[model samples]
Target: MSEIISDLNTIDKESIRIAKKYKQKNKNAAGSKEGTFTKIAFISISLIFVVLMLVVPLISVVINSLKLGLAFYIESITTEYVISAIRITLLATVIAVIVNTFFGIVASWAITRFNFKGKQILTTLIDIPFSVSPVIAGLSYIMTFGRMGWATPILDTINEALGTDIQIAFAVPGVVLATIFVTFPFVSRELIPVLNAVGTDEEQAAALMGAGGLTIFRRITFPHIKWALLYGIILCTARALGEFGAVNALSKTRGGTFTLPLEIDALYLSGSADSITASFAVSSILVIISVIVLILRNIVEYKVKK
Candidate 1:
């Protein structure tokens, strides 16, 4: 009993010491006020220009989007082509997000939860899309899939073998493929750091608790990184919605290539002033979508952290 009391005293004394030390560190030391002011001044100055440049352009986009009137905005937002493009873009983005979510979980699990050959190389390969130009990204697909390209004969043969005509170029499927390729890395990269932080111990512990793979993943893994997953999904959706270079690169730029972006270009090139305004109107719609996604992501991430 005496030893127990002594131990309690020692712990209390140690805690008190720590609290005092922390207080001192946070106290107004001799030069801390000046140093603090200097740091604040430097950051304020540096961020001033960044805020001006970034915020002004963003505000302009929003202001322009709203300038055309609520009825006009509603009509613009609900127009047949705009609606169809939104549907197409959302469908492609959702499919890509789903595919990449699985890949993110699998790849991060494989990278961190196991060891294998050429792991570093695999990691580097995952980052290739980030460095590659969207234009070149589209070209690589074209080189493999276009009419005169290497795999065209194979595609043709397969279509004949199946007793059906199949054309991939300048179509919805091509746009989807481009979206998937470009947005592949977002979720995986987002999850890597989160997975690294969570580590394998909880996973192992779940196994010891008689949890199966699905149970282990659901109960132990998913919650830890759900925010990151959502962040990646929102970002990927935004990128896919705004994707222009790759879609333009692979598409025929005619009938089958009538995406909202392409339509905007065509309208601006040959149509009247109203069509040009409609182009900006479409752009303004996309910009609004991107902004909403970003705001949702911010809220979700902040809540998760809290």
Candidate 2:
């Protein structure tokens, strides 16, 4: 009897343990199902949002651009004013990219490799373009370089000395200046984090081995930041290409200083159906360029990751 009782007790304990384990497994399965449902719901919402906001608008632009015909689209984009705007846009973008790239590299090097007074101030100054409005920037430039402005005397003296018709406000130079101001911080901002993450160990080692500054940078620093620099250049190019507000404030002459964005605005504001259609056609060009830039950016990002 005692042996039987002991065996019965052992069987009951085993049954209870298995029941608890089975119940716990069922609870886990239910939790997992709920979690999966939540994930799928979030992903679905994101896809819907992207399709509505981005894909639809892009598709609309393409369709409207071709709504008339390919010849109309071609004619619109090839007109003298449109061609001039394209040229100016490309010129501004090229200059901005070059200037910002050089400045970004130097700024990143100085900020990362050394310690000095006003370091924080310099960093903040670089970011001013981001915090301030582009319209405000353009107005400020006008006030500084306009005829009645304080810098007027200096500009007049320089033009007299150079014996050339050089102008800043309400000219091509002013447009380029505005583009540069807006896009200047992009490259530097992209580089700062990369340089910080890379640290200064290898640069210091190269210097200790008797490498001069340029040699150290070329051999040691350049390799680490090349991808980052390329990424920054692409970003700066894209931003400069589409800059409108600042350029608009400074550009007074259509077909002379107008960029692509400004040209599009001019077409739209003409208050004619044909002009509106032409505006969309020109906008498609920008859309295509932007898509190309987006693709390039993704490629650079992939390269950096690899």
Estimate TM-scores for all models. 0.79, 0.94
Q: Which residue pairs clash in candidate 2?
A: none
What C-alpha lDDT do the candidate models reach, one value each? 0.78, 0.93
Model 1 lDDT per residue over 1-306, tens place: 999999999999999999998888877574699898999999998799878988777777556655666676566656676666666667767787788878888898788778899989999999898999999878888888886679889989999999987676666777778888888888889888888887899899889989998898898898888888888778887787777778788765444445566656665676676555566677777666877987898897886676
Note each model's CA RMSD in angstroms: 8.4, 2.1
lDDT over C-alpha atoms for residue 113 of model 1: 78
lDDT of 1 at 235: 80
Candidate 2 CA-lDDT value: 0.93
Off by over 4 Å in 2: 1-17
Q: Between which residue pairs do clashes occur in model 1?
A: none
